[model samples]
Target: MQIQLEFPAALATVLGMRGLLIDGGGTLRETFRRIADEYPKLGLHLFDESGGLREHVLCFWNGTNTRWLPSLDVAMTEGDELVIMQAASGG
Candidate 1:
């Protein structure tokens, strides 16, 4: 199955803002790992040494936050749309 990936903000600098077609047929974990393999930079920003999402970034799929799901373990199917967005904060 092919999934649609969209990157936002600084994240988009690494992977332009648009739909990226990705093949995902394995477990979600494996699929994410595959994405990392394809774009090593995104993985760097997505995780820290402690293994948590960076405070500056968040992920959403089809208008729903992935934080509510298992994230890397969330199952993916064809035509699934994902967005990698940077969280906003200001004083």
Candidate 2:
């Protein structure tokens, strides 16, 4: 299976690309682990010290926020897209 990844500009700079295609199957967590393995620097920004996703980072899986998902262990299908964005804070 292949998953698509979309990153914000800041994070994209770390990976040298705004979008990517990665071969992944199984749980979402496992897919992320693979990404972390390949792009450690981008992973730093995606996950926090506790190995959990950062509060300020938003990960949308197939158009739905992963945070709102029942579990990170949710199985991902081929062509699923994961978009990473930094949460906006202000007034």
Candidate 3:
């Protein structure tokens, strides 16, 4: 399936583009792997040294945080949007 990726300007600067479309995977993990393969630099900001998602990074699948989903193994559908953003915090 084709997945639409959206990112903030800061990240877009890092990625050298505003967004992208990629052949998604059966599972979110697989999608991430594909993204890593296509954009290793962007992947660095998304994953930690141990290959875990960075604490500041949030991935929203179809407007829902996958972390609250029953599983990250959720399958992708055509036109599914995966939005990547950094968490915000302030006093």
- On TM-score, the leading prediction is 2
lDDT tens digits, residue span 6-42, model 1: 7765666766654478887765666667777787777
- Once model 3 is optimally superposed onto the true structure by TM-score, how far is the C-alpha of residue 58 displaced, in angstroms? 0.6
Q: In model 2, what are the clashing residue pairs, if there are any? A: none
Model 2 over residues 1-91: C-alpha lDDT tens digits?
A: 9999999998667868898898778899998888888889988888888777898999999999888988899998988999998889896
Worst 10 residues of 1 by lDDT: 10-19
| TM-score result, candidate 1 | 0.73
By lDDT rank, best first, the candidates go 2, 3, 1
What are the models' TM-scores? 0.73, 0.91, 0.90
Candidate 3 lDDT, 1-91, residue by residue in tens: 7999988888878868978999986888888888887889888888888666788888999999867888777788899999988889996
Relative to the unseen true structure, what is the C-alpha lDDT of residue 3 in candidate 3, on a scale of 0 to 100? 91
- Segments in model 3 whose C-alpha atoms lie over 4 Å from true places: none
Better of 1 and 2 by TM-score: 2
Alpha-carbon lDDT of model 3 = 0.85
Clashes of 3: 0
Q: Which stretches of candidate 1 lie over 4 Å from their true place?
A: 15-19, 50-52, 70-72
